[model samples]
Target: MLELEFTAEDMARTRFAISPLWEVVAGLRVLLGADEQGLHRRWAEPVRARIAAAKLDLTPLAALVPPPSPSVPGFICPPPTTPWPSLEVELTALRRTPRELLRALSPHARPGVDAILADPDRRLGELADLIEAYWEIAMAPYWPRIRTLLESDILYRARRFAEGGTRLLFDDLDPQLGWDDGTLQIAHRYVRGVHTLAGRGLILVPSAFVWPRVFSTTDPADLPVLRYPPRGIGTLWETRPSPASPALAGVLGRSRARLLTELAAPATTTDLARRTGLTPGGTSQHLTALRASGLVTAHRAGRVVLYARTRVAEELLNGAGA
Candidate 1:
């Protein structure tokens, strides 16, 4: 059992973020059968082939992550501190990790880990390079679907947090998590401790590949993080049936109807473009029309604007069989 006590400052400071780097690390664990719950079996098969075909080197990353260990090195890729960080930004942070933090990996070194710790500077750079390459083969292609699922969870959870404070925030977060008074408890597999957040607060990260288990980091040097599976992982990889009905598509053009349908969960123009295979410019034009017609409203979340369905649009969808 892992328990965390929160101060008032910690509560105010706690925030949500979606990390690309977290997916790369956790996805590898699932692919290699360490954290496998059969949720990602279909994803693992094709990604393994992609890695083999590209001759991607998994030695360094796989060493730090798997074969089911008690803990992973915090410096490998510390949790992202913001809602949206590009993979490149995360890789840069990985390369700049302080040398002293290398102590996290000094225990129970895996095969390739010894050689990596041997030359911290050079080895860390190579590790970052390898992670970037691995991202292209494993994460980039399917990121649209993965990110949409995560963002939707964030939106829903944020609202709950706002409405009911800490209790409602974590009440339904996961079976392994608990909240009472000022403490948050997590039923972690290999981690156990009682930590008081000395005003530094916590970061809640929702990961696609962390299904069936939860991960947390309590190092003082890093903002505390609890990584767990998002709400819709069971169907994350399945193909979604089109939400746009024939009549709706006829009333609006096929593209506009599809754009509005995608907004059932708030998303950005770029996200809609990738998911729907529409050009960015075309998506922007369609979104503009929808906004003008009051079918959708755009609200900014952190660095990006999220488009959500207005009540008018939701009612239309219900009546349209969408």
Candidate 2:
């Protein structure tokens, strides 16, 4: 028998999706060199400052984060006990009814993503709030502890990306080398999510909420946990940067030609996929190749991953010899 039990809260969660802000962070990492270790090192101090300014009083929890690890750079050590609610409870709620779970965890507020990003003065604040809000929803039971770590992490990361992208733009990086519309769109989603949660009591205000999922690993104590891939597809790109393999170059060239020809006003992976009839993932592969060749640069405008041809790309595309 199909039972229909409805609650406004339940309805909201079902609609929950990955926040676009996450993708923004990803674009920033790709554009700059802050994959994991680089980000940790760059933002450690800023993170600590933000935490202190917020007066969240994380001194009690400081003892728990593991000492800096080269292998896991900036990774905090496991806590003795789960700080938030039990993982079992959180998981059961999520699995039993994903929608209800999202609603329960999500903030009951709306601050459109565009509204926030549009404001020059408030952009940083908006980005922090958005990142924190999403982390609050996704991290679930680990909220308190993870949030503390994240408050610092997100601020540092967002600043890095925004500032870094600004530099690239001013440097006259060929407009083609900048991120596309899709990435910007994804970023907007994140901005909206953050704004919505801010209006709700869920956001702590001044202190950002950090999403635990940003961390690649899980707490051993939170056993039977779900593990997702970390930011940046390290495996996709080799550890040491070098020229693409001949086979790889041939494949990338064919795709690049197609992508550039289709692009207008800088398109994102999704845009490219829809217009060029290539799968989203396939398009990302081509973009990665172009990125490796210094022929393109990608950024997260909102949610979508935007790819643009670099000056080098233009030269390659325009070379009379070609």
Candidate 3:
């Protein structure tokens, strides 16, 4: 039972953000044990082999995510505000992790925790190196698709907020989360406390790897961070496409028809490219044609442009199925 007392200002300031580092850290948990992480078992199998083949030291990273404990440190996985935070930016924040914070985490020490506490800077450097290496091998290859899923979730939630305000957005986020009066409550198994935002507000992060459980920062000193698994993660590993309807394909051409169907959800050009097995440039061209025909609509969200099927396109899709 984690109770967050939110002021009106805090509610107004709550915003959605994506974190690459958070994904990397959350992914470590999936790799450490796959039995409980049934949603990510498929992802963990190949990723585990890669980690072993690359000879990456998982001890240090593994130390950060203990087995369902209440002592997990908040500083290690700081909430990231940027949609596409660079590795250097994330590591720099980690390098500046306070000695006291590291000390708090020392009790749950594993193979490399002692070294990190003794020489925070040097050990943090080594840890950052490990994170980068692990990320390159496991996450980078699939990041575009993962990011697209996260971004699509954000887009959906933003619309929800606009339509029904904060309560509706938080209510639908997860069964464990709720907003009543001025408080946001999270029913977590291991974490229980009442925390006031003190006008610091909250950062809602959607994660592709954090399924079946939500994560948050326990330290009062840190920003209020809530990380929930994004919708559509079950299909994150699915790459094979359902064959486009022959009627739709014949009328729109194979590539255009495929792109239209894929736009059932909002997606970036890169995501569309990866999903459709088309190049980004080719995907953009098809999107442009679709937009011109009013079958798709494009909207800019931060640095990325997302395309979704227009109402007209939805009707056409429904009619095609009939």
Candidate that scores best on lDDT = 1
Write down the TM-score for model 3.
0.73
For candidate 2, lDDT tens digit of each residue in 146-247? 233333433443454467643332132211112332111112111222111111111011111121222221222221111123223222212122333344
After superposition, the stretches of candidate 2 with alpha carbons farther than 4 Å from their true spots are 1-252, 320-322
TM-score of 2: 0.24
User: TM-score for all predictions?
Assistant: 0.75, 0.24, 0.73
Per-residue lDDT tens digits for candidate 1, residues 27-103, read 88888786546888767876787688677778778988885676667777687866788888888888887766665
Tell me the lDDT of model 2 at 137: 27
Model 3 RMSD in angstroms: 8.3
Per-residue alpha-carbon lDDT of candidate 3 for residues 1-322, written as tens digits (9 for 90 to 100): 9999989888877888888888887888777662384887766776676667667777887876755554455666787756567768988898888887666654655444667777888889888888887776677645656777898899999999999998888878988898899888898887898989888889988988777788887456677888998888788776444567899989998999999877655668999999889999999999999999988876543345667666577668767871
Backbone clash count, each prediction separately: 0, 28, 0
- Lowest-lDDT window of 10 residues in candidate 2? 198-207
